[model samples]
Target chain A: MSGLVVERATPLCQLQDAGRFGVRHLGVTQGGALDWVAMGWANWLLGNPLGAPVVEVALGGLRLVCQRDACLALAGADLQARLDDQPLAPWRHFAVRRGQVLDFIGPRLGARTYLAAPGGFLAPAVLGSCATVVREGLGGLAGGGRPLQAGDTLDWRGAAPVAREMPAALRPDLAAPARLDLVVGAQIGGFDSRSLFDAFNADWTLDTRGDRMGVRLQGPVLDYRGEGLVSEGIPPGAVQVPPDGQPFVLLNDRQTIGGYPRLGALTLLAQARLAQCVPGERLRLRARDADSAQREHRRYLERWRQV
Target chain B: MNPRIEVVAMDALMLRLFDRIEEDNLPWLLAARQRIVEAFGAALLDLVPSYTTLMLHYDVTRLDLAEARRRLAAALDGLRVPEDDGGARHTLPVWYDPRVGPELTRLAERGGLEPADVIRLHSERDYRVFALGFAPGFAFMGLVDPRLAAPRLDTPRQRVAAGSVGIAERQTAAYPLVSPGGWNLIGRTPARLFDRQRDGYSLLRPGDRVRFEAIDHATFLRLGGDDTPLAPTGRAAA
Candidate 1:
């Protein structure tokens, strides 16, 4: 019966989980946490399943008042969080007294933050996920694919776990210059050797035109020498080169089919890191073999399971 | 020939069956997809079938890239290409109202044909559902009579209403949701292409066959077609 009442909210706040799966064949995009790592950690801090529903607060500007004394977990971006006007850091579980106000003022470290309540937030599952996809009008508090707004109440029924703090070594290093690892795609060889060199060597800046759908990378113009390709299935993290040559990394909510030639797709960890990057953040690309990329992904999942 | 498997991402693999979309490729792609689903079972997170590629998404924790590739290869080897008897056929009733299709006259003019001829050409042939994308339940049906082939609008409309039928190049499809689109509008259908409340959210799936049937306005209303214009009425062209 414990809950938090939304006192203020921004359009960016929405409910998310690991994402909707097994439904992309129906032309429905996978909608979930942009930064899956952060969402998992937030849920882990509460002893909830990794895929439990949580509020994804992007660029902050959200305020909530505890309706009852309860425990919650915060992870991902710092977002300049404050508890009753006092600074509250992320990556740990904390308790709040009744009527205590939790305000996320703005971003400080990363672009997105995850807030998890005990047992996750109560939301109707549409297509086996509570992850809100506003484009499809599915999921969310009311289950109509709407973002959190003022005067809304978030209810959860599970009890909180023992307080815990994320190990310093395991905490994501958001301040470090991002170096994304990309697995070479089928079309990689079709790109001009010069453009391919620039794609890997040149520093790429994250463009301001980005959302849950994709993030455009501003860097060298990648000239694809391949002829026009028949439209085909596009996977998340696929770095597609448009006619203008700017590469955009598709994300959870990308269209299912596309015709653009892809340099490659980023590793899962790289995608998580990219999700936290703000506009204008500079990053470099590194080519990774398929074997190493798969091993690394497995290791990350194994660590989470062990934790 | 064996399908070429390419690692699309850490957890995704794209199996390119052919370079071009052809009727002969459907059976192989469909059989391969079925076999992979049966072989991997729950380990396969998602499988997306497009015109000529099948993207398999798996949980890296459950199956590594090498293991997934091996399993997929084994599955393909065991696949039995079923006869191409065609797929489920649905007769979709369409109301070819000129008021609903803002570009109907323009499209006919470009094709050097009358408006009625354009409608007849579109309705006479059965289209195959090649893939579903752009939006949920939006089936990309194909090979619209070449005579009806026309370029997309120079500028896309801000919003195309749900159920609006559209043609672009050699393809024809109906919009399942109100969204920005550049396809030339031709008619509107009443049948819901996508309904979340339904057992199957999408009415038409890949491999299905669909045919448009011309219907009078009264029949359109009888079949639950709302009189609402597919898009905002009287909107200036983009």
Candidate 2:
């Protein structure tokens, strides 16, 4: 197989696509790239479908050696990526010669990076997706939910297109403190007025103990005056307020169902932005209506339809 | 009764079908899920059926939230109660003993009954699979015999072996995979509740009816049950 070989990688590095869908009823989580916007752009640069399988590299420490000359795209989280000693900025496609090494040292801006090959690195789809969910032990290279490891070969079949660069204006600014748009619903009325006020007004810090399943937010102790709830299906980006008062945003790999009362779920773009946030990053939540958030998400997807 | 629709996100809407968890509500919820799935076609990303609600996650690129709600409401109007009686029926074999079931004696003592009474109470009636969650293949079956009802342990055990039958309050379930849990374990089952290679990936789903058949230790081993003694974890639960 003429492709790249993983020389070294952290457990965080895994193959991801759009996600596993239509199977939530089986208690299966939708696992995919946390920063789906970046994953889309990476595949877009390579002329692949927006949801083509791409490598989601978090907190760097991944190294690959090219076995043959090939072209690939990199997007999201600068991560201080380099090609055989040469610094490579993200949001563009680049070429690699045989025997050259691609190294991701560490995060410079965002916490996650996406790397896409021509037709997405070849991997058998498990549960209709190649997205890895380590908790469920499903999807990924070898179709066993394991992350990329040393000596593993990654091959793609599609022909490489010409090089392209994402417009600077379209790139997300990782430096800014993200203002996540929370579509308030669920048990919002159950929360006390004071806690609700503090929730939107005060800045929340991203807790260090965050993962693909969920991210804990430390800020105001949200008081839930509502009655206890029976377990129910949890949507992606659902901000659940446990008894502790601190809120946690459930992500793609979250449990299919939960009983905790939710303040609301983050808008699509806000979730993609939250995926790039590093621990201790200060952020604020802004309330948004469902219709407006829907329109904004449609507009974001429209970018791919245009040109 | 028509369910009240609540917008939970940009691409999601939760239909509140009932206020309490009861066997009577499952058919309507399952029927509603089927209707919405058919109504949305490719636009429906996922429809999750839980105890009292069906959460519909749609593709925003195809249909906006307002249109989704409108279409969902129309589809659910005068919904026909499914002719199929309470989904699929399954009979699982369980070995009720203190060897694999650490809480078997404790639960029996709490209920003022013998271990045999606890087993009989659990396996006597059919339970409804209300939902699947907490873990892959973990079917949340419910309505454990009120006499055998037990509370979840104050501290959850770090690992509950796969196929362990457990009870928490009125709900009862089997641990599909080895995972941390707080339920009162009463026995072990040989059946695999979840298999990725299986057609549905999960043996039980929402609306399905399940009955537990008490089995002997020798029968459990014959049915592929793991016999390696559960090492004493000094845990009060699981």
Candidate 3:
């Protein structure tokens, strides 16, 4: 089978798609590309489905050797990717010769980079998804929740189309001091006025202890006077405040249910941008109405459809 | 009665039926889940039923926030509890010994009860599976006998064995996978709470009723139970 052989990779490198849905009720979390916007753009460049499985390389350190002539798309963070000693940039699709080497040195700006094939790398689907979620022991090339490893071969079925490039306007600037849009949740009213004021007014720094599950935000100690909460279903991007008052934003791989009070959830676009942020980056939370957030989300999806 | 609706996120809504956890709410929650599924057939991406809430995740492109809420309200306008009894009943056999359950003696001593009495209290009542989270197939069953109600450990153990039957603050559950947990352990069950080969990849579903049946050591081993003692021996606590 025509494919690429993995010569080197870090643990953070894994395959992902839009995510696994209709399975949260079974205690399964939705795992996918943390920077979903990049995943979509990569797939779009290949003329593939926007949610097709792609390799998500975080803090890049991966090297692959093409086994056959293939056209692949690269998008999201500038990982300083190189194709056989030639400098390669993101947001574009290019061709590779058989036995040519592809290397991703390290992150130049963003925290993650996405690589997409024409029909998505071939992998057996588990629970109707190829998205690898290590914690749940599901999905991936082997359908065993394992990340891409050295000596593994990745192949796809579809034929590649004409090369394409993403417009500069569509590309996001993954710079520091990000302003995240947060849609207020039910527990917003229960927090004291001072806590609410501190939540939006102050700047929060991303902590080092972060992963696909969640990221801790270091900032003012907001207070919560709400009664004890019963454990309930948690949505992606939920900014939950524990008793200590420090807030943590739950991500794609977060547990299905939790009991902590939440200020609200970040908009999908904000989640994508946050995925690109490195540790110690400063960010501010901006309150956004659900209607406006939803409208913006629709507009983003429309871009993919038009493409 | 209409449930309180909360905009959990831009694409998610949580319909809260009650503020507190109650077994009686399971039936209503199950019925609400059915109506909500039927109401937003294709638009609904996921529906999660918990202790007193049913969280719905919708595809924003298919339906707007207001339209999703209107459909949910219309479907639940005259919701009725199904005439049929709640969910399926499951009887799980457990090995209640100190070796596998290190916290058994402490929990017994804290409640001023004999070890046998502790097992009896835990096994006597049928608990309802409220929700599943923390790990795949980890069912959060609840409403334990108040006498057996115990608070979670001040510090969670680095690892809790799978199939460990435990209680935490009026809630009872069996660990589906080995994970970090703070629940007070009372026994270990031989039954596999989670199996990937299973239809749903889980032995118990939300709304199911489960009862624990105490079994002898030999019986436990016969059912493929592992009797490896936890790191910290129960004798130390005893």
Candidate 4:
């Protein structure tokens, strides 16, 4: 069987797909690739489904040796990847010979990098997804919520397509400062006008206290006039404002429900972009409506199909 | 009833039935969820029902925001009392031992009652499952008897044992796994609230009713409550 043997692995490396859905009612969170667009593009290079499982490497400290000759695709963060001491850039598919060693040194452009096999890394589906959620202890190569480790073999059966590089025009510009689009929620009215102005116009720095679960924004203190909110279902990208006044954008692995007042939620594309931002990166939030956000997402998905 | 509909994200919308949780609102919310599932079918990704809100997660690739909103509004218009009244009622066996819950005495003192009386007040009422959240299969059930409505610990415990029953104000919940929590621990249950091997995984769900039944330590052990400490740091009582 065509496979790759893990040589050196980091705790951040885990198998991911679109995500575990329809299970949030059971208190299960949706865990998947933080940079979903990159994951999809990686699989697309191999002619696999957009949501196929792939290895999500964060900050890059993983190394693998090819056990068989196979074609694989790498997308998302330019993790300074190298194959047998030769420099390898992301957003392209390539072939690896048996015994060749692939190393992911560290991130250069973005935080998370996605590596895709032809048919996606083999993993048993748990709760309708192979999205690894360590907190929940579900979905991983071992059929349990564990990150990839040395000695673990990753095998995929799908046939590899002709090697190709992602078009330069199509590649997402990760170098630019991100302006995340947020669709103002009903609670937006409850925020003071000054706070609301600061929320959108102010430059917010990504706090060091960030993880897959949430990214805190350190900026102007948002004065919320609303009384204590009843705990409600918190969707991915919801910008929840805690008592401290700092807003945290909840991510894929966030808890299903929370009591923090929310200004709004980020657009899906913005969330994908936010995942690439490192700690202390300066970002601004742009308020958008539901219709435009939907259109933007549809356009993004359409581009994937066209590719 | 017109719900306050707002965009949760690009592909999800939150429908608020009421400002506060009410028994009557649950039926309509449950009915609305069923109608949405029936109407949207594959387009609907997930439905997260919480206190007074039902968030509908949909696939933007399959349906546009306008269409989804329209379908959701239509579904709400057709909402009626569910024939089954949500899910089944569950009777969970709980061990109300002070040895298992260290905070039981303190919680009882705050409520101006003995630990045994506090346990009695807790187990007597059939609490409605308001939501399942904070952790996997961690069911948040409600309206604890006023006498047993103790506040959460001032400082949260580093690790709460799995199946530990806790109360915070009006809400009571059983911890599905060993996790950090602030709720005042009162008892423990041997029941596996969350099991990955099980088909449904979560033993309790939203809209389900739960009644706690007092059990002896012997019965708790027989029901698979091992005496082994659950804390990873070995802080749990032996």
The candidate that achieves the highest lDDT relative to the unseen native structure: 2
Please give each candidate's TM-score.
Answer: 0.97, 0.97, 0.96, 0.96
lDDT of 3 by residue, A1-307 (tens): 7589999998789989899999899899999999999999999998888898899999889999999898999998989999999988989998999989999999888889999998788888778788899988888889888998999889886885656767888888886569999999988988999999999999999999999999999999989998878889998799999999999999999999999999999999999999998888899999999999999988888997775
TM-score of 3: 0.96
Regions of candidate 3 where Cα sits further than 4 Å from its true position: B233-238
Instruction: Give the distance in Å from residue A74's predicted Cα in candidate 3 to where it truly belongs.
Output: 0.9
lDDT of 4 by residue, B16-41 (tens): 88888776667777777788889899
Answer with 2 or 4, whichever has the higher DockQ. 2
Worst 10 residues of 3 chain B by lDDT: B229-238
Clashes of 3: 0
- Estimate, for each residue in B1-238, the C-alpha lDDT of model 1 and write its tens digit: 4579988887889998888877567777778888899989989989999889899999887887789989988988856788764578999988887767877888789889999999999999989888899998989888888889988888788778788898989989999988888898888899999988899889998888899999999998898876676543335432
Task: Please give, for residues B1-238, the per-residue lDDT of candidate 2 as tens digits.
Answer: 6479898888888998899988888888888888898899999889888999988899988898778978998998888886784589999999998888888998899999999999999999999998888888888887987888888978788878899999999999999988888888888999999898889889998889999999999999999999655644446443
Stretches > 4 Å off in candidate 4: B82-84, B229-238
DockQ of predicted candidate 4: 0.80
Q: Place model 3 in a CAPRI quality band.
A: high
The TM-score obtained by chain A of candidate 3 when compared with the true chain A: 0.97
Q: Please give the C-alpha DockQ score of model 2.
A: 0.82
C-alpha positional error of residue B166 in candidate 1 after TM-score superposition, expressed in Å: 0.7
